[model samples]
Target: MFKGNFIQNLPKIYGTYTGGFLAFIILMAIAENAGVSKETIGILFVAFTVCIYAIIGYLSRTVQVDAYYVAGRQVPTVFNGMATAADWMSGASFVAMAGGIYFGGYTYMAFLIGWTGGYVLVSSLLAPYLRKFGCYTVPDFIGTRYGGNLARFCAVVVLALASFTYVTAQINATGTIASRALQIPFELGVWVGLVSILLCSMLGGMRAVTWTQVAQYIVLIIAYLIPVFWISSSGNYGIFPHLMLGDEVAKLGELEATFGLKENSKEAMAAMTFADGSPVKGLKYIVNSHAGVPDGAMAAWKFISLVICMMVGTASLPHILMRYFTTPSVKAARKSVAWSLFFIALLYTSAPMLATVSKLSLMDPSLATGIIGKSIAEVQSIDWYQAWNAQKWMHIQDFDNDGKLALNEFFMRGDIVVLATPEIAGLPYVISGLVAAGGMAAAMSTADGLILAIANALSHDIYFKIIDPKADVRKRLLVARALLVVIGAAGAFVASMKLTSILGAVAWAFDFAMSGLFFPLVLGVWWKRATRQGAIAGMIAGLGSGTIYLYMVKFAENANENIILGIDHLRFGIIGASVCFVVMVVVSLMTPEPDKATQDMIDEVRVPSGKTVLGKQH
Candidate 1:
């Protein structure tokens, strides 16, 4: 059957999340004696993993390097969509995005809106054209398009900057999931994940990752949907009777209001500012719980920077762009994106439901309780406002000994929801283990792909092209494998730090890609006048501007407006992207365009006079 499917058989994919996932099962058999939640975790440990090599082996015995890197560039449209969805919806999408909406209000929906909406641009404007080039990676496209090694080198720099920055965060997410699911040290969990990715992906390359990701997509979505379905069924079973997400959204809203805020949470969602009622700017005025955290105090640039990263991020992402190459045809490439969005919607819709419901759960004192502030007895009832602070991983602080939690006292972890869901939902330990496995799936799948992409660039783009043009395939693979280990270790080192949220780390990488490279790449592809000088200049300016802008937004908050074109990230991205485009155009007007040879190649990529070409050979 579909041995490529990991969820259908977990033992196969065990090495992907770490052999620890398999080790988790043997330990689960002894869990009762060990005082760990056993059966549920054991079922999940078994059910979610697969004997991946066995399944893949059974699926296809003989394979070529082409299949490893690009699934032989002939994956079916629907399957490619599912696999890409899995790749696109990495750990950041699975874990941090919803909690983002939770704390950020409606603003965070931009993740879905940006990523989803951006696909329209991808499929219509970029993906099919890129596929027409018949390249294995983004750098390959750049190298072949301009027929210049310098162009390829620039693309490599931009892609590496965007992808590797996120590699650590994904590894960190894997480790966190492991710590919760298996009760291991956070650092050890990361090591296990790193080893798993290095083993499965380095040896197999894209050939292994594509099949594994397809299987994982199935596993990840099922694992996610089961818990969500359970929550929905427990609340209102009728909605699951073949209804779609919109109707389900209405049902969820009703369920949330069906139970009022726990008495303690009456103070939630305070206003952002008060212009009419505030007469005193001094301490003599009375402050009510209803009064919100005033403006001019909150971190606005953080919000701006995050949105900038996301809006500009997806188009340039290496793993994401590479998936387009796997489609059986350029037409398949376009069709797969629609499918990718459809599959992605499955979880994205549920994510908001989970966040809203979790918010409700946190507010319900009965489920969340034991203590509030300094007194366990103080708010003996449910209070959404007060309980919101309980959601904080950092802890609540009360200054001046008043025993009241100020708005600033509350600090929450983005990953906390995914990790803490076991205790929060009152689910068994097994479910927690399953969730951990899910996060690991997201992390390792992405990590493996990223590490492979990095290795390919170094070995093929730099080494084979420059150092030894006559390098054999075997030697190239050897060099690629060696490079994988180096990059994997670097990723592991960063993941072990475990400081930022997976979403935040991923977002940072996206900002670099979106702002620095999207403009240059897009213009280089379609614009007739895009000279190499223009392309190089745009890349430098886009990359430099985006980088400096991010540091300003992150570090020198006081000068955010002064430093960054004084706009929101969404708006600023438009500005930064435009800056790249305009600079490229202006520079190109002053210089000669690439020779007619380059122009002819551009025309070939742009004007497809016939159906998409598709095939594979070994």
Candidate 2:
């Protein structure tokens, strides 16, 4: 089945992805209807999905340097796009994105717009030209462009920092899925996920990662669509929930109005709290807040700042930029970006709908009407609430000392919304298992891409280029595989700490990538006067400033003072990026222009069609 040209083999791979999943669903339905427990079914679903990815990874393994680094540069556009989309939508995109929207409301539009728009920037400014330039890693582009080892090293440091931060979050997400699916402790689940991540990535590098991501994309798209459609159908929102969910959003607004749940009010703020005697304090209700809707200049400034950060960050991510290197040619790279955006939009557009449908379901009159007047015990009798509470995934307190329940009295974690949707809608256990599999697919696919990005930067850029230029391909491959293990272990360790919010970690990583690399990368390709000195200076300033800003926000007592122009520290990447752009332009003007060779190299990539030079550098 794998013994043909990529075009010829494409259908078979797609068939395997779709057909294998259908078979799993059929078998799971039989087992579930035949009296299998939910836990057993969930375990089977996750195991089955992982097994499929593992098989793909194992079969696609390659020791050849080209295959190891960039999948032989033979991936067709459509398949490459699918792989890129899968890589782009990580664990945060899968599990926490909708939850973020459900909790933060209109403010969260930054994620949707920034992420999607970032791809437009990719196709326009980065993807095709990078393919034409023909580099193994993002740092290779930087080092070669600037003609210095220092540029390369700085690029590697920034890339590793951002990618490692992002990968830890993906690993953390894997643990979250595993713990919920297997009903195991979170720490044990982290190890299970770490082992599975290694199994998928260790053998093949980019070759394994590319094909496995395609399969993962298939699983995740199906997994995401199923529950939303099921809930939509059951709720009479029609079969196409993505198009029909506005009505549900309207219904949610009505319910909020009826319950008098004003998000910005002191009453609403007062309602938020952790479980009684819960070590965590200052946790307020607004589990779903409609607070501080973006209304004026401050809102616009904050929104635009976050959007810019996300857009630049998305375009700057090394793992994502590496995807274009796998495509067959420059034209293929451009075409692949279009397909990538289309595939990603499938989920991005649905996310808001999912958030709305979930909120509507939670506030459905039938399930929630009597709860407002009932005792905590009586509310516990409700199956959905009881099931979620029993798992300790959610906690509801009788805040306000009222014996009866109110909208603010019921506080559940946002993480539980998508995972518990199957039960909330009274769907069968099979669907629940399927959702777990989907979440795992999302996490594993992104983890595979991120780990490869880090491993390649170490082995190819740092080791092969600088440490041991005389090293053979075999030695280089060995180093890469070793780094994969080391990096994966390190990321898993940080993930086990679970210190930051999942989405917060991802956001910070994006901020770091954009701030440090965005100007140096974009200017290197498009601006001829950009010099090594300028690139180096800009990167240090940007990275140093962004890192300092993030540290202050995370650890300093006067963190609030760090907010500039009323923008939060999380959006400070916009400031960092702006600083870098200015520094690069000014420093380049003060320094000598790039050599003629460098200018010609930049011109070579500008051609729409060119040979993609192979090996470590163009």
Best of the candidates, TM-score: 2
Window of ten residues with lowest summed lDDT in model 1: 282-291
Model 1 / residue 543 / CA error / Å: 0.8
lDDT of 2: 0.83
On the 0 to 100 scale, the lDDT of residue 566 in model 1 is 44
Q: For candidate 1, what is the lDDT? A: 0.63
Task: Write one digit per residue (lDDT tens) for candidate 2, span 303-341.
Answer: 788888899999999999999999878888999999999
* Candidate 2 segments whose C-alpha is farther than 4 A from its true place: 1-3, 263-276, 280-293, 366-375, 613-618
lDDT of 1 by residue, 1-618 (tens): 336653344445433544454455456546745675554564456334634523542453223657655767767787778778878787888877656655554556657676776677678767888887677678777776656788778878888887888788877876766654555688887776777676566666776777777767766776676666665555343346235344544543443344321222223323211223322111110111111222442345444444555655777777787888887677788899889889888888777666554554443334433232324225323343244333334333332356643333333565555555544656655555566667667776777778777787777778877678887777777887789899988888888886665666776677667766786667767786778777777777777776666566655667555544345333434445667777778888999768988787787777655532222421
Q: Each prediction's TM-score against the native?
A: 0.78, 0.95
